[model samples]
Target: MRVVLAEDLFLLRDGLTRTLREHGYEVVASVDNGPSLLRALLEEKPDVAVVDVRLPPSYTDEGLQAALEARRRRPGLPILVLSQYVDQLYANELLAGGDGAVGYLLKDRVTNTEQFVDAVGRVAAGGTVMDPQVITKLLSRSQARGMIDSLTPRELDVLEMMAEGRSNVAIAATLHFSESAVAKHTASIFAKLRIAPSTDDNRRVLAVLAYLKR
Candidate 1:
């Protein structure tokens, strides 16, 4: 339950720290940049790391690179990266040498606090978690729809947006509704899809297999 969080934005970092602590996680270290993140990975020896793909200095893939390097030094180091968008290439690299215990989720998913907390625990305990967006992009339309059904037309649309990693704000804009309305749709989608509460993580392990095989 010990965590090291790496995010450059102050508000997000603070929010994540508060969220995790509130859920009974011990955040041993919270740093902003890639180099610092890498160092903390080694120094803190935390149970898990919640990282952002972009970081200070180069502001490109530094945080991801540092995470990779940190894992290189210590294989199977649990890590859960949060991103604004899905990056298949980055995901492939992170999952390269690990047996499991890694996750890549969109920043939007944070709004579902229970799911977010579940993801951290799962990764820290050596489970693989993938964002729905990554799963959708890495999959063909036909291939992706097999496991999901029973959703209403509206719910399906909502689910598709969720798969694309759209935040409520973005979804609202696209669907022309209030953010709260989008949230309601998301709840319905989760319910219909059988994405149970924190117990399962629904953090489906299949997406990792799909990414690996791709």
Candidate 2:
């Protein structure tokens, strides 16, 4: 798979590039600044983009803005955002489109390189992936709205794992529940979230969106 990377730090950028390349992903373009990142996304049209939330030339959300703009121009272009902090505002904006093929992960918490590469692969395959820390913060913010208050604690737990792009079987294994039980929880979550049945949208992604937007 082809990838475009944007990170200002040379060491981390080099390490990430080497890792992805070792894992068989072609680093089509590696950029340090927002403008170059934007140009690479528009011109290279790589299969996936691994971008940082901040970049040079006014390093406050420049990389994020560039990624969002690229997605605006090319909808469904997969992007995996790597950030040192969990900015709820940035996370909300990234998930606001409610589209799959997006991820938000904390750089410091990623101890396993394989895990990071797996997340990139999942996002490229049109899946949503959220760091555990990001999910926790988003859940905390959703509580104030009382929107997800209706969900049982177990349901909330199930939803959190779902937001992390786990399958029903995987969630079952993680939670020590049967697949049928997980499916039941999922169905209940959909109903409580008022996520109506729709063929066009992924209920799992929409469920996460409902909570994050609330």
Candidate 3:
């Protein structure tokens, strides 16, 4: 797939480009600033764009703003945003856009080459891939709310494991409960969170994140 990379760090940009290329992805263009990155997106129309959360000049949310702009310009273009730090506010903004094919992951996660590449592919395929850290922070915030208070201690344990990306079978084994019981608890947690019964796992994760961010 064709990709445009936006990052201000020279070493990181070069390394990431090399890695992506080695993985068979074409690096259409790499830019150091947000404006130029946006220009490249318009010119290249890459299948996906990998961006750093910070860029030149402001070094704040410029990359994120560019991602938003790209979404507006080409609604189907996939975007994967990497950051040195986890920003719940920024995560909320990205999800607020509504459309899928968006990802927010930590830069350090790039070290897991296979996982990182897989995440890129998932985003390109219009799926969401979020860093586990993002999920942890959101879960922590959710736990603070009285929403979780309604849950039984065992149910809370199940929810925590789910936030950790554990499957029902895994959580059941860990908690010594049957898979059916775990599923029941998961359903209950979803109900308490006001998540629709039809919500997919990824969206459930995002809903959990949103609840935590709230």
Candidate 4:
């Protein structure tokens, strides 16, 4: 897979490039700032772009914005965002585009080379992979509303997996539950969360996001 990498830290950038290359991914371009990253995306049209959540020129959400812009320009281009901290706001923004080819994880996750490479491959293949920390934070913040408190532990687990963009089959496999059981839990979650029964994935995602932002 061809990738464009954007991170301000030289050591991390070099290490990432070497690791990804070792894993058989071509690092087409490695940039240090948002503007340069954007330019590289436009010029290279890589299969995927791995970016830091914070980049030069303010070091706030520039990288996130660049990733969003890349998605806007190339609707199917996959993006994986790495961060030193968990930020629900950034996660919301990254998934707002409603494209499935997106991932958000903490930078420390890269130490697990196999998992990190798997995440990259997943995003490139039009899938979503969020850090467990991000999912936990969103779930905790949403639970503060007392609404999420209504859910059983299993129901809460189902809802959290849904928020992570997992399919019923995938959640079932992950939780070691039957597909029918997962479906029931998902239905229960939607009812408790007040998400109308719908086949639309984006609506479900929005419902989960609304609960998180509450």
Candidates' TM-scores?
A: 0.68, 0.88, 0.78, 0.79
Most lDDT-accurate candidate: 2
Clashing pairs in 3: none
Query: Which pairs of residues have clashing backbones in candidate 2?
Result: none
Query: What range of 10 consecutive residues in model 1 has the weakest lDDT sum?
Result: 197-206
Candidate number achieving the greatest TM-score relative to the actual structure = 2
Q: Model 4: how far is 130 from its true place, Å?
A: 1.9
Better of 1 and 4 by lDDT: 4
Stretches of model 1 off by over 4 angstroms after superposition: 140-212
Model 2, 128-165: lDDT tens per residue? Answer: 88877787787675643464777898998887788788
lDDT of 1 by residue, 45-120 (tens): 9899999998999888878888889998988899898988666677777766547788888887667888799878
In candidate 4, residue 200 scores what lDDT? Answer: 55
Off by over 4 Å in 4: 88-90, 109-111, 136-144, 196-207, 210-214
| lDDT by residue (tens digit), candidate 3, 13-61 | 9988998999999999999998998899989999999998788779888
What digit string (tens of lDDT, one per residue) describes model 4 on residues 1-214? 8999999999989999999999999999999999999999989999999999789999898888888888888887899888887666767766766667888888775568887888899789887777767777756656446767788999878776776567788789999999999888888877877777666554565557655565
Ranking by lDDT: 2, 4, 3, 1
